[model samples]
Target: MTPLAGIKVLDLTRVLAGPYCTALLADLGADVIKLEPPRGDDYRHIGPFQQGESALFTLNNRGKKSISLNLKSPEGLALAQEIAAGCDVVVENFRPGVAEKIGLGADVLRKAKPGLIYCSVSGFGQTGPFRDLPAYDLVVQAMSGLMAATGEAGGAPLKTGESVADLVGGLFGSWAIMAALVQKARTGQGATLDVAMYDALYSMLTTSHALHFYADKTPERVGNRHPLSTPFGCFETADGQVVIAVLTPAQFARLSTLIGQPGLPDETRFATDEARTENEPELRSLIEDWSKGLNTEAAMVALAEAQLPSAPIWGIAQASDSAHARARGLVQMLPHGVLGQAPVVPQPVQFDGVKLMTYSPAPGLGADAAEILQAFCSVDAARFEDLKKAGVVA
Candidate 1:
């Protein structure tokens, strides 16, 4: 049996961070019930649509059921409370106080259920100086100092190519939720998890942040170079650029021999890591002078033979199609109701000999409203019809 087969999750989150967190839970075999507004989640309108449906939304929201309700209405709020009282987990990404305004806040739900695992994912957090401010992935990236540490030296600060802040927030949130679940099993108590996008991103900037904390010096962008380790950056080769990271003295010595600069490491300027770092420009140029004549594959072979860490930069397509990725079953092709076959990244954890597979398609707006209300609430067909007529459920 799947680890989380018996657990049920009430997912009230929309967009990236929160949805991604719930997606992980769903992958672990939780019975996830996505509660949407009458119009559906805002991500449905995001680009890269297929057959008038959002592929982006499908990627993060598969393997869950959807039930639409208008929380503004008293009946709708009551229905949601009933679902929360029965579910093991509730995840929401509304701005601070929004859930409280809708009468579904952690305190209220915890009082009702007593053993509910409620996780709140927001831009800043539930209680903080920036709690109420509106934030996006780019805003969090810039505020967390990640932008300042990225990109070329003296160039405009660049946000990462992907939505790292959002993705990390989701990953951390899921991890925290799982830990809380384990704790609940042992303590017979529930947990209230608060995940903030900016906080998560800032926590991940440890190396650069450490320099400022201990040395009182902020790290500047050096573009693909290690902030502390010498000879740990991209080098130009005949075919393309290859990255090499020779961090230790032994590795440096081996690298020196491999690059035909045997006595260079013993030289005063490049003898130790500190010395090499102090003379990075000259050292890098000397390495590049040798690499510029060798092709990327040949350079990689030489570096590998010398026991150095080096690899060619790969684009998304190349990485996705790589032999290692294929062997590990990192990606899977699943049936998307409207998008035909969709490629989805599987959950990172593998249990026993089984990998989690997609069990259901992304729901159409309110697709399971009637079924859910009937099964969980024991609401008869007549009552469901009445609620729909009253504009409570769509």
Candidate 2:
């Protein structure tokens, strides 16, 4: 509902992590100005294009004004500092020290505006030994043990289907910025946030933490199943796979009845979660015998009728195009000249049964430069023309 209506965010970052955080702020009604080089963000040229507009870029940059500025120029740097002086927050995802080298470091900006919230997104944190090492989603996921804990037990480690590390970093970045804003509101003091992809992704592996921290063991790659629970994985049906999520004894009992073995849970080997996990193979065999005879829908229906939790695995397209997604307003269309309408996928938090916010289409490169410059920097038409002519701005 435009909670951050008057807040200003200067998005100096590009690619996924920085864009994602700024996108969230923009969706929540912050006036986000995405500053890019004259050539624009690399994502703007990346593939999966629709009518020559990069879908990847359009999806994350919605509702933000774009300003193409040449930060390498001395005048451009001064303008960036000036624009940032008027903003509430500035977020960057450059390598740890690059912002300082480029003359827009936290100290410089905080001195210019004491209450400014500066966020830096990186592969590793600013103080860590690995902070100097370059990293990507794949690197973080693999190093943080998320990839190691994924996939089938005997198979090689695997990365998630999506860029989870990057997304997780962005998520924490947004959370930290909001938290800093809250603190600033109370104390009139700014914060310098250091959000790392490695830390964020590693923190998200709760199950991995459970095994490594409590049990002194590495979490095994358990594939689609809940690692410690039996009968909590995908079961094959005649048509496709159905997910079974029987966790508690009550759910397990219902599952037992659904599989035509009501007393199975009472058996010594299957009486407790630990016992059932120790004998998972036998339990899986029994569950499949019942499920394999039915189609996925049939199995799902039968499980539902028995009050057991079950679901069917759907591809991305199938899930996104489902009735539930449409009904919940999970996908909203934003008008775009190139694509006619580009889908804006926002967080799925419902406020009083309504979507949190709606965004306009992502701006074209430097599309809002003049408006943003006039509004924030008080740059007149002549000065704006001079800057553009000097290649200081585009």
Q: lDDT values of the candidates?
A: 0.89, 0.90
Q: Name the lDDT value of residue 89 in candidate 2.
A: 97
Instruction: Tell me the TM-score of each prediction against the true structure.
Output: 0.97, 0.98
> On residues 88-195, what C-alpha lDDT tens digit does candidate 1 reach at each position?
999999999999888999999999987899999999999878999999999999989999888897898999999988889989988998898899999879999999
Q: After superposition, how far is residue 239 of candidate 1 from its true place, in Å?
A: 2.4
Residue 236 C-alpha lDDT in model 2: 90
Q: For residues 295-320, write the lDDT of model 2, one tens digit per residue.
A: 99999899989888889998989989
Query: Which residue pairs of candidate 1 clash?
Result: none
Q: Which ten residues in a row have the lowest lDDT in candidate 1?
A: 353-362
Candidate 1 lDDT at 389 equals 97
Query: Per-residue lDDT for 264 in model 2?
Result: 91
Best by TM-score: 2
